[model samples]
Target: MEMSRALDISAAGMDAQSMRLRVIAENLANQDTTGSAPGADPYRRKTITFAETMDRGTGQPEVQVKQIGQDMSDFTTRYEPSHPAADAQGYVKLPNVNNFVELMDMREAERSYSANLNVMQVTRSMLTRTIDLLR
Candidate 1:
């Protein structure tokens, strides 16, 4: 019973980290995405927040996605007169997503996910061994 609870908690953590990874991937994929029209804003970076909630059945704290929100940081501007998104001043607004930051976030998310997976595997193995001992 405790092992099952552990498995459930780890699964929840893995799910949250997976969502974080997805958000990071989207940010990376849209790093170069600029606005389609002049003076239009480019893609804004997305951020994932996690919260712990009590699972009613298990009475355990489980990680959950709190929100997928936009980053309010100012977008970088590039001087590109010929670009379609260029403004009157020949400056184009770029997405706020930074590749380096996204990569770092991705690495952290991957580690969290891996750790949760490891926990789940260990819990499952222990449960299996316990069942075997009884038989």
Candidate 2:
């Protein structure tokens, strides 16, 4: 029973990491996105936050996505006087997202997911062995 519960916990962690990775991918995909119309705001990078909560019915602690939030960092500015979205000062505000940073975050999320998976797998194997030994 304990082993099964451990598996559930690890599985939940894997799910959370998967969600984080998805958000990172989306941020990377829109890194170059800019304002479509003149004098418009460009894309803003988003981030994910996780929280742990107790399952009311099951009385188990589980991980959950707290929120999908904006980065809140200042936009990057570049000079592009000819650009349609450029401001009166000939500068355009770009998304604060950095592709390299997103990639690094993705790798970290992947490793965390993999570690949770390993935990689940090992727990399953141990449970199976215990059952066999009792036979």
The whole-model lDDT of each prediction reads: 0.94, 0.87
In angstroms, how far off is 111's CA in candidate 1? 0.7
| Candidate 1: stretches off by over 4 Å | none
- Compose the digit string of candidate 2's lDDT tens values, residues 6-123: 8878988998998998899888888888897656778889889999988775678989899999988888879999998888888888988998889998999999998999998899
Ten-residue segment with the worst summed lDDT in candidate 1? 1-10
What is candidate 2's TM-score against the reference? 0.92
Pairing residues by index, what is the TM-score of model 1? 0.98
Model 2, runs deviating above 4 Å: none
Give per-model TM-scores.
Answer: 0.98, 0.92
RMSD of 1: 0.7
Question: lDDT (0-100) at residue 60 of candidate 1?
Answer: 97
- Cα displacement (Å) at residue 14, model 1: 0.4
